[model samples]
Target: MIIEPLGGSYDRKAFSCGVLALDQYLHELANQDVKRRVRNCFVAADRDVDLIAGYYTLAASSVPITSLPEDLTRRLPRYPVLPAILIGRLAVDTRYQGQRVGSILIVDALRRCAQAAPASFALIVDAKDDKAAAFYCKYGFRPFQDRRLSLFLSVATALKLFG
Candidate 1:
């Protein structure tokens, strides 16, 4: 049940969340992304079984201010883009889906972004599908004006959640 940086001990090839792309990313690409400093991959790993229960990737990102709903942007500084953190991917092994593994991973991701060295105003995610989008909405993420599957939640709120 420990969520830590991905390492060689976990059986990457054994993870399958019913999505081919996500499964491939974890099996074939996550380590490269980490080594390239492009994204940080964290996994909920079980030491005894060498199994990965779930995983997520985080990276620095930005959002166009104009893409946000007017009600959300009207009070912000007029910068064209706002600094943010992207939860590039998140997936739970089918065996762990009903166990709140995804929720735990997202909370961990938000905590990291809230305490990041560089400031980030929000945390964003591009859902792979409508069902995934609904999971994020439970955490208060709002959709972008033009991207229904893309959503964001304020860092301030994340801070409040664990303050």
Candidate 2:
């Protein structure tokens, strides 16, 4: 499978991660978001079958230092807000579960963000649930004190893994 930018001809209907909302986003809103320059959505598709295997979206964002835990705040710059790239959503088709597709998509997202200009300091993701939070935690993401489901990983750390 290969990851590529979402496009007109890709098969979005056949993609389902067992979540109606996520599936609906791909089928109904992904293209529109792309056209409006809202978020950049990337899809993983099987080269032979041409079916979407998984996908994720990324957008520029920021986090207030005041919202972070004291330990984290101590290490960051004195600036009130820190630049970041948000992983708006991530899901893998149920058919491709346990195949590491989600991990691949995440690595791809981090690599893209790391190489983007006007560099961001970290990658942030809002986990839909505890399970999703665990998945991200496995990749070294830490939750802010105010929000357990909201996690972050520094760009420096991500680049060390994927740069």
Candidate 1 contains a number of clashing pairs equal to 0
Per-residue C-alpha lDDT of model 1 across residues 1-163, encoded as one tens digit per residue: 8999988678899999999999999999999999999999999987778899999999999999999888878889999999999999999999888999988998899888977899999999999889889999998898899999999998887778766
Given candidate 2, what's the lDDT at residue 163?
59
Model 2 gets an lDDT of 0.90
lDDT of 2 by residue, 1-163 (tens): 9899998476799898999999999999988998899999999988788889999999999998887778777877799999999999999999999999999998898889888987898899999999999999988899987998999998897778665
Worst 10 residues of 2 by lDDT: 154-163
Candidate 2, residue 162: Cα displacement in angstroms equals 4.4
Model 2 bad stretches (over 4 Å): none
Off by over 4 Å in 1: none
lDDT, candidate 1, equals 0.92
